[model samples]
Target: MGNFVRIPAGPDQSFDAWIEEPPADRFPGPRPALVVLPEIYNVNEWARGVARRYADAGFVALVPDLFWRLEPGQYLPYTPEAQQKGRDLYARLDVAASTRDIGSALAWLRARADSNGKVGVVGFCLGGQLAFLSGVDATPDAVVSYYGTDLHKFLDRVPQLRAPALLHFGETDTRVPASIAGEIERHKLPEQDLVTVVHPAAPHGFSRTGYEPFHAEADARAFEQTLSLFARTL
Candidate 1:
């Protein structure tokens, strides 16, 4: 249902992105779009798989290879040795550069036939933080964040997205400590609209199957609620 391709992000720089379209027989006309953001691994098989799932659900899904600026088509491992490399690469990333690349994808979607010009942002881990930030630059239809990494650190940077927002988190996620998540829950807004769901037994990456160590049975419930949020808002 999809494949990877390279596209220009800025002058003399190209990035890889997984573009997923629903089967031709299933998708007949223009549809909404979803920008699928990845975890620390950038655009890995799992991330692409998620894009396909979104496409199956009637969205044009795009997963960009954020690490491409440094190395094209790179996928780091979760091992201790590779973890250091991933951290180094993560540290080198310029937030403005990433938002620029993401904006390019959004522009492509809005102009394409499969998009109704309605866009939503969804991501896990590092990508989740970006999802929140993306809201500041543009008005998306909605934003969904899952156990967002470093979002608490940039809470001040959190965009007052006029669009509705739904956040999912794990109560036990040390990466996004419960304390900070609580603070996020306590904030007031002009819209006074935000949904924050905490999966009691899960931790960071709880929505992912392979993160079974931290996964919870309740994550399924959270997912259903997330879909409902999209339906109501997007």
Candidate 2:
């Protein structure tokens, strides 16, 4: 259902992205495209699964390796040691450059013959934060962030968002608590009404299926809302 493709990031730099396309017989024409941002663990199996899910839903999904600059093809597991390694790599990530890479991905998708010229972005964990940044800096048609850590730091940029945005947070998430989520909701600028959902008792990484701290109910609800958002906006 998917394969790796190279995308030009900047001059003399390129990165691999896992691309999945919906069945042509079922989708039957140019379809909306999606840029699926992976967590700090990079384009691991779970992240690729996300692209597959979006493809099955009739969208062309592409998952870029956000950590390519630091480690070209690193795919860490969900173990404690791997978690620490992911965090370390995440700390060294340059947000501005990664946002540029996302823009390149969007451009690639839009240039594709199968695209309908509509593109959206959905991200998890660290990717979630990048999604929010993309809303502020890039031109994705829509944005969705799941439990994005340090979102409060960028609350000031909410007013600059040109695309409709949906953010999901876990009520009990230590990285992004309910108070922070409330702050984001309250910081709306004029018509920039961002939809935020805080799942009750859900912990960080709630939407990550087959992983610890995954809340099935929250995952289902957030995914439904995400699909609805893309349907209406993209």
Candidate 3:
């Protein structure tokens, strides 16, 4: 369970976000926060479920509506039509503006009364790219990227990433084939704290529950790795 909130993004602009907070009795004081990025499906049930998962794990989770610029409050279903529409929106997106919204979301989390002033970002699919891009803008405590596609485009900014990062990839994913992921790994700066994992027998959307490629063992391991990262960094 979460509620919608408006977070200021830019000059005269704000976006909708889904806020899931941990139970007050369980977490009486400020708690660590996480910015959970959704897939191309936007902030639908699956995305909200992720936010809730983080809440149940004792962290305040926030899911920003990444498509606010073009279609505010629009939640796309998991269908062919929705996928095409999401791809269109993703293609036309202004990278600069999207990163700004991410910065705003992180800032909002840090300033929340219930926040412990430490925030970690975890993203899936398209959101995975945003998680990497956030390093170029905001220096969050930690970042976890899952099967992010087209990361080769942001290799130039790898040196700017200051936080510890855990990147997950499915060995069988055609979208981010081993060759491409290896290139990304090669670009990792010597000083950057990064760990890259390639899971065998897993596909593109292995972490997603209802997806055909969903692999429980791989997803659980990935999540455990993520929690360990945040535990040490956040």
Task: Name the runs in model 1 displaced over 4 angstroms.
Answer: 214-216
Give the runs in model 3 whose Cα sits over 4 Å from its true position: none
Write candidate 1's Cα lDDT for 1-234 as tens digits: 688877666678677789998776887776888888888777777788788878888788899887777766767655677667667778888877787777888877888866778878888888887887777666677888887777766666544655678778888887787566667766636464677777776777787755444464866787688678787776
Pairing residues by index, what is the TM-score of model 2? 0.97
Instruction: Indicate the residue-level lDDT of 90 in model 3.
Output: 90
- Model with the higher lDDT, candidate 1 or 3: 3
Q: Model 2 — which ten-residue stretch has the worst lDDT?
A: 185-194
- Model 3: per-residue lDDT, tens digit, 1-234? 799999997678888999999999987767999998888888998899889988988889999998898887768888889999989889977777877888888899999887889999999989998998886687678999999878888888877877799889998888877565677678888878988899888889899876667899999999899999998987
Which candidate tops lDDT? 2
Q: Against the correct fold, how does model 3 do in TM-score?
A: 0.96
Off by over 4 Å in 2: none
Error of 3 at 206 (Å): 0.7
Q: In angstroms, how far off is 192's CA in candidate 3? A: 1.4
